[model samples]
Every structure is written in C-alpha cells, then in structure tokens.
Target: MIRYGILSTASIVGRFIAGIKESQAGEVYAIASRTVAKAKEAALQYDIKNYYGSYEELYEDENIDVIYIPTVNGLHYRDCQNALLHHKHVIVEKPFTLTSIEAQKLFDLAKQNQCFLMEAQKCVFLPTTLQLKKLIEQNVIGDIRYIELKAGFPGRFDYDHWMYDLSMGGGALYGSATYTIELMQFLFDNPHFQIDGSCIKCPTGSDEICNFQLKMNHQILVSSTIAMNVPLKNEAVFYGDKGYIVIPNYWKSNHLDIYFHNGETKHYDFPYQSEFVYEINHIHECLKQQLLTSPIMTPARTMEATHLVETLYQKWQEDTNE
Candidate 1:
C-alpha cells in the first residue's frame, strides 16, 4: 500500500486523510505540523502512526511514498517543491499556488524527480459531476450556451488563521473560486476560451468575492461567482438551445436536474460521501499506468483555470489601485 504523509493539521486535511485511510491501495501513515504538539494531536485523532514536528522531517522520511499538502494557499508551492525534491508524490490543495509560474515549477520538479503531482480539486471526481460531464459530451442538452455558477459561505476566519492574511494567500477568489474555475475547465475542456471578470474585496484588501463571465471556444458562455462572507449556496445552471441543466449545491453536489424544450425534465442523484474516495481511487489508477497525473485533473488544465483566477485578481488589484 502507498503510505501517505499529511503536511498540516488543517481541517481540510482531515477529510483527505479519511479518504486515504479508506482507500484500499493507500494508508495514512504520517503527518507533520509546525508544532510537535499539533502534529501529535492530529496523529492521535486520525490514528496516524507517524508524526513529525516539521514538514522537512516528514518529507525526508523515506518510508512515506506520498505527501498530501493541505497547507495554506501561499505555502503550497514551497511545500510541493520540497516534497517533490524528496522524491515523494504529492497531492496539493487547490489554488495550486499564488501563480501559474509556481505551479509550473512544482510540476517541472515532479517530472525531473520522476514523482507524481496533482492538484486535489476533488469535485471533478464526484459521481454527479462525472455524469454531468457525460451528459454534456453526449449532447443531451444540444449546443451549449450560457452557464451560471455561484458558491459561497460565510467563513469563520480566525485572526490567527492564515486564511485571513493576504500574504498567506487568503481570499475567496483564490480559496473558493478554485473549485468553480476547475469545474468549468473540466466541463469545457482545455484553453477555457476567454473570461472577462471583476471582483469585490474584503476589508483587508483580499478578494472576498468575485463574478465572472466567460466564453468557451465551443461558443459556450459562462457566468460564475464565489463569495466568502455569505450564506452557503452552491449552484450551476447550464443553458443550451434545446434544454438546460441545474445543479444545486454543486461544489459537492449529488443531484442534477435537466430540462428540455421538448417538455422533458429529468433529475439525477448520486451517492455522496464526505471524502472523495473516487478521486483517490482514480489517482491509484493513474499510478498504475505510470502517469504523472490524472487526465481529468491534468496539470495544464489546473494551471489554466488557476491562471484565470490569478488574472482576475490582478485586474481587480490594478483597477482598485488606479
């Protein structure tokens, strides 16, 4: 079994660790945190056998075959680089890095080291998400038109938490919009067409929310938004000449309703799990094929989607400063 090492005591890592523990081909063997107390506490809570006080120690551990880096956004680049340098496969949390350049560097290092690397953008692996992609490919909705997406929830940002700090890469656009952007990338396939967008920032000068309108090369237009200081609402609406598809709570959605101009309407529901077992299983399949990353979540696509977000933020920053 592949041994997994977790890089932080971050809450999201708990779900990922659970997924790893449940995977038949992998095990949650170790975890590291800046503080030994935190690492030991997380290890005990998650039943992890090995714990390290420093990330370097965990990366240096030869027994660990893979590292799951769920640290804050800004740390992803450095953490991933270190893990790859140690010759360990790595799965990093979304917003892959502050910029596509950093992401490319990590991917390059992974290639040079002959190790695997992937962004842990989990929604694409959901059964509903997969089925939706299939339906779109099958042209069940006819030619695609405009798509609308929105996902947001009021965040409890701790003053001590890295998420509230701009330098630490704290922001709704980078933190949450990564999911929406990646989903669009998955549905539309590469290059993602053109996206013209704007954003709203938090009092701290971080992007607290964003709204975007984009068009795919296939002539599919999309409108999307993400907000952190708001109630939880996640939805996506896909419009086509002959019909439309609506997915409510799409980030981890399990149900999809499709409507057609021909007076036909259908709803689909897929089983749900707190953790993404299918995504992890797909990773195992990629490993078996000796692939560096899963095709569905390719690094290029991740970079493209992530680049869109970074570009939006840059534009917003420019406009605000002007």
Candidate 2:
C-alpha cells in the first residue's frame, strides 16, 4: 500500500483523510504541522501512525511513498519542491503555483527526480465530468462554438483571511475561477487560449470578481465570470450547433442535462461519492503504473491553468496601476 504523508492540518485536509479512509490502495501514514500539539491532535483525530512538528521530518522519513499538500496557496511551490527533492511523489492542491514559471520549474524538478506529481484537481475526475468528456468526444455537442461558465459565492471572508491577501495568491481568479478555467481546458482539450478580461479587487488587493473571455483555436469563444461578492448559478453550458449540455455545480457535478434543437431532452444521473475519492484512486493507479503524472490532470494542463490565472492577475494589476 502507498503510505501517504499529509503536510498540513488545514481544514481541507479532512476531506483528503476521508478519501484515504475510503481507498484501499493507500493509507494515512503520517501527518505534519508547524506545532507538535497540532500535529498530534490531527494524528489522533485521523489515527495516523506518525506525526511530525515540521514538514522536514515527514520528508526525511524513508517510508512515506507520497506527500499530500493542502497548505496555503503561497506555500505550495516551496513545499512541493522540497517533497520532490526528497524523492517523494506529491499531490498538491489546485492553483498549483502562483505562476506558470513556478509550475514549470516544479514539473522539471519532478522529472529530474523521477517522481510523480499532480495537481489535486478533483473536478476533472468526477464521474459526471468523465461522462461529459465522452459525450463531447462522441459529438453529443457538435462542433462546440460557445461555452459559458460561472462560479461564485456570497462574500463572507474577513479582511485578514488569506483569500484576501495578494501575497497569499488569494483572488477570485485563483480561488474560484480556476475551477471553470481548468474545466474548460479539460473539456475542450485545448491548452492554447487567450484571455481578454477585467477584474474588481477587494480592498486588500485581491480580486473580488473577474469576467473574462477566452478564444481558442477554431474560433471557440468561452465567457467566464467568477466572484466572491455575489452568488451565481455556478453552472457550465456548452452550446453546439446540434444540441447543448448543461451541468450544474460542474465542479462537483453528479448529473447533467442535454437539450437538442429538435425538441429532444435527455438527462443523465450518476452516483455521487466524495470527488476526492476519484482523485485519490487515480493517484494510486498512477503510482502502480510508475507514471510520473496523471494523464487526466497532466502537468501541461496545470501549467496552462496557472498561465491563464497569472495573465489575468497581471492584467488586473496593470489596469489598477493606471
């Protein structure tokens, strides 16, 4: 079994711990936090066999087959780099790095170390998403021309939260919009896209809302809007010449609806388990196959998403500066 070491006691870690409990191929072998008390508390809560007060201790443990990082967005690069350097496979949370350059560097390091590395993007592994991919590939939506996606929630975070800290890689583009960006990339199978957009920033300098238009090869137009100050439909729709597919809560979808111009409507339903389970299982399979990265959530895809986010943020910064 793959022995998994988690690098933080962040709230998100609980979801992954549950995923580990549900999977047969791996188990929570260790957990680490900046404080011994916190580490020990989490270890007891999860019944982990080993607990460390520092990430370095987990990295130095030879028995850990993989490391799962759910730390703050800003720390992802450093932690991932260290884990790879220590020869441990890593599964890092989304918004893998603050920039494409950092993502490229981490990917290169993983290659050099011959270790597995993946962005923990659980949405792409959802059964509904996989099914949607199949339908799109089968021309269920013929020759996609336009795509619209939006994700947002009502504003609730305080000023001091990392989500509002620019230095922490906090913004609607990175925190909320990334799901749609990555989903669009996965669904369209296109990494080459351009963005023209604008953003509204919070007082703390992080983006509160973003509206962007993307144009891909073949003149595919994708419009996306993400915000933290308002509630949106949080859905994605693909419009084709023959029909359209609509997925609600596309990021963690379990069902979809298809409508045709000819007045035919079809609905598909899927079982819903924690989406994390699918990602965890995919990682387990990749490890078994000795693969360096998951084909579903590839390094190229991660870089593409990072590049888009960085570009949008830069554009926002420049606009704000002037």
Clashing pairs in 2: none
Candidate 1 global CA lDDT score: 0.83
Clashing pairs in 1: none
Per-candidate local distance difference test:
0.83, 0.88
lDDT of 2 at 318: 83
TM-score of 1: 0.94
Clashes of 1: 0
- Put down candidate 1 lDDT per residue, 224-309, tens digits, no spaces: 88777776458889888889999998877879999999999999988655547778888888888889877889988878877887
- Candidate 2 TM-score over all chains jointly: 0.94
List ranges where model 2 is wrong by over 4 Å. none
Provide the TM-score for each candidate, comma-separated.
0.94, 0.94
